[model samples]
Each structure stands twice: as C-alpha cells, then as structure tokens.
Target: MLSDKERDQVRQTIEQQIAEAEKEMVVLKELTAAVAPDNSIGRISRMDAINNKSVNDAAYRNTRTRLKRLQNVLEKVDDKDYGLCMRCGKPIAFGRILILPEKRVCVSCSK
Candidate 1:
C-alpha cells in the first residue's frame, strides 16, 4: 500500500494527465470537422470529398483511441488501482507510472 504522500502524488499526476488528454481529444475533434480543404479551388469531384472524409474519419478514430485509453487510465486511478498490475495484482513500478501516469497494466502484464 502506498503512503499518504505517494497517493497524493499519484492523484496530482492523474489530474494533469486527464487535462492534457481532454485537450488532445478536442484538437482531434476540430481536425475531423475541419473546413473544406483550404486550397486555390473548392473541391470539385465527389471522389475528392470522399477521400477527404476518409482522412477525417481516420484521424477521428486514432484520436478516439488515445482519448479512450486516457479515460480508462483515469478510471483506474479512481479505483485506487492506478499503479496495480491488472494481471498479477502487483504494484507497477514508479518509473513506469512516471512515463505513463494512466497505464493500467505493468510491463510484464502488457506483454
């Protein structure tokens, strides 16, 4: 079990990570809904529109995945299981937590 000081430190880390993740997700949303391609001529072909749509979709999907992972990590923190390895039930190393404050599983469990 972590001491009170350790738990407080983890909580601060969780809050910082959550804020950064939210901003990242917002930027993704903007990119997905970006205005028509900024160029000399407005798009002419339906195919062009489709292609742009696909690109937007891909960006959105990738961003969603990242945001979801961050959200899951935040949830784990709330459970007081933030640093615990999901598979082995061991506390994940502090170094890993510093690298990925929202990571759910330890390196071994991740593999």
Candidate 2:
C-alpha cells in the first residue's frame, strides 16, 4: 500500500505525462495534415510522404491510448488497490510506478 504522499507524487507525475502527450498529439496532427497527398508532388515523393504519414498516424494512436490509460489511472490513484499488481495482489514498487505510471501488473506477473 502507498502512503498519501507517495500517491500524491504518482498523481502529479501522471498529470505531467498527460500534458506532454497532449502537446505531442497536437504536433502530430499538424504533421499528419502537412503530409496529405498533393498531385504536384512526384509519385515517389508522394509515396514517401504517405509512408511518413502512416508512421505518424500510428504514433498518434499510441499516444492517444497512453493518454487515456494515464487519465484512467489518475482517477483511481486514491483507491486502495490502485498500486497493487492486478495479477498478484502485491504492492507494486514505487520505482516501477514512477517509470510506468500506467502499469497494472508487477514484473513477476508480467512473465
């Protein structure tokens, strides 16, 4: 179980990560828009742009997923089971939570 102070720290870190991911989402949206197909561009250049856009789109999706998970965790941060490993019911290390705020299982159960 985590002390109140520790939980507060985790909440603050998760909020900061959410803010950064939101900012990145905005930048990715702009990049995706800029890469839209243009007839004036050569076929090869257009193909490259399409590929870049695909990668950016995937990244944008991942960021959105991560943001959602973080927000959900933030809402549950004060719950009694918030820091417990979902699979093992053990207290997840604070360090691990700091590194992976969205983690729901411990390293042992992850195997």
Alpha-carbon TM-score of each model against the true structure: 0.64, 0.92
lDDT of each: 0.70, 0.92
lDDT of 1 by residue, 1-111 (tens): 455576667767767766776777677676556455555555565457667767877876866676677667656555666578878889989878766766667899888
Evaluate candidate 2 by giving its C-alpha RMSD to the native, one decimal.
1.4
The TM-score of predicted model 1 comes to 0.64
List candidate 2 segments past 4 Å from native.
none
Deviation from native of the Cα of residue 28 in model 1, angstroms: 1.9
RMSD of every candidate to native, in Å, equals 4.0, 1.4
lDDT of 2 at 30: 82
- What value does the lDDT take at residue 45 in candidate 2? 92
Where in model 1 is the C-alpha error above 4 Å?
34-39, 42-59, 72-81
* Steric collisions counted per model: 0, 0
